[model samples]
Target: MKRRSLLKLGLGGAVLLGLVGGGMALLKPGLVDKHMSPSARELMRAVALSVMDGLWPAPGAARDAALQAHLDRVDANIGGYPAAVRAELSQLFALLSSSGGRLALIGMSQDWPKASVAEIQELLNELRLSSLDLRQQIYHALRDLNTIAFFTAPEHWASTGYPGPREIP
Candidate 1:
């Protein structure tokens, strides 16, 4: 096939995939206007485990509670965003929730819950350094959200060596 034909084929395939992904998101409006859905929570948990690796306590009840708390904070933070931003996030969550989106976008063939922290970290690094603007943007959004949620809690400040804000004179 001619180079031009191949380019067109690739572009057409991307568009088709985008359309299918959008349709799937619309079909499942979990994260659209509401609080974090189960899938979204799971996605964020996986991301948090990867991004906040050493920050988390050892694998036990405390770690589990901390993870849950982080998710709650993330949900709260997302809730405060404007509707348009929330809608965009909803679409992003929906896309990642789908297997095709996970593979095509993040190169992760497994479901979020099943994916290991190392796998997630590798995908996140790839996203961070990817040539594609969309992938990089996704990485930033996920990283920013997780970091913001984890850091904003006063209880976590000690871990970061950020003594609570100095008292007013």
Candidate 2:
């Protein structure tokens, strides 16, 4: 083929490759997993610890692992919701993750992970008592999701006086 035709073909191939690469990148999950964004996941970690304070394992590897398990369950539960609901949750999580949002909503200037249990409890209490309906809803949603995930485990059932499902003989 002539030099011009060869050059044209090469450029076309490059363009096609670029387009395909960009498409794949867009489709890839990036920072957000199937159900939660990175910030959202981070926020949930702190929230879980706070909401399950007395119930949470003592600070150690076991506690870390338990927190992750609960977060995974929470993620799975969030995945079951419709797209719109998921989007709203994502937005809420992201907002809470930000410094400004944390201060405004939770009244905490420190990072979520660093915030003490008392601080978190206070923020949650404030949220629950807030005159704003949205704040109250946010508090309930976070508390309920964490509780549901924590109690879903069989071990937690014992604490609640719930025996494992009984099979009919």
Candidate 3:
């Protein structure tokens, strides 16, 4: 194919993919809002485990509770974001929740719940180091969300040695 044709084809494919993803997000209105759908929650839980690693609690009730709290904080944080930012995050979450997206973006064929932390970590590392700007952006977004959620709680501040914000008179 001619260079012009090749570029056109690629651009067309990208547009189509974006439209489909946007449609999916629209179909599940809750998915695009501050409230995370079940699938988005699961995806983020896996991402939190992988990204937080040592900071995350061990595999037990404490870990489960901590993860839930982190997710709740993430939801609250997203709620405070501008509409456009929320829309973009919703699209990213929708894409990652799909099977094809899981494989293509993170190279994980299995569902998030079943994937091991090691596996998820490897995939996340790939995204972090990927030459593709989109993948790196995804990595940063996930990592930042998890990090912010985990550390914002006063309970977790001890780990980072962040003394509670100085008492303002």
lDDT of 3 at 52: 78
Candidate 3 residue-wise lDDT at 89: 86
Count backbone overlaps in model 2: 0
TM-score against native, each model = 0.94, 0.76, 0.87
Best-to-worst lDDT order? 1, 3, 2
Tens digits of per-residue lDDT for model 3 on 1-169?
Answer: 8999999999998888778777766765435447788899998899999887898777799988998899999999989988888888887888788876666566778998999989989988889999999899999998898888889888999999999899889
Model 3 is weakest, by summed lDDT over 10 consecutive residues, at: 24-33
lDDT of 1 by residue, 1-169 (tens): 9999999999999999889888978986448456877888899999999999999999999999999989989999999999988988888888888888777777778899998999899989999999999999999999999999999999989998999989899
Single out the weakest 10-residue window by summed lDDT for candidate 1: 28-37
* lDDT of model 3 at position 10: 91
Native-referenced Cα lDDT, model 2? 0.76
Screening candidate 2 with a backbone cut-off below 3 angstroms (N, C-alpha, C), the clashing residue pairs are none
* Candidate 3: regions farther than 4 A off: 1-5, 29-33
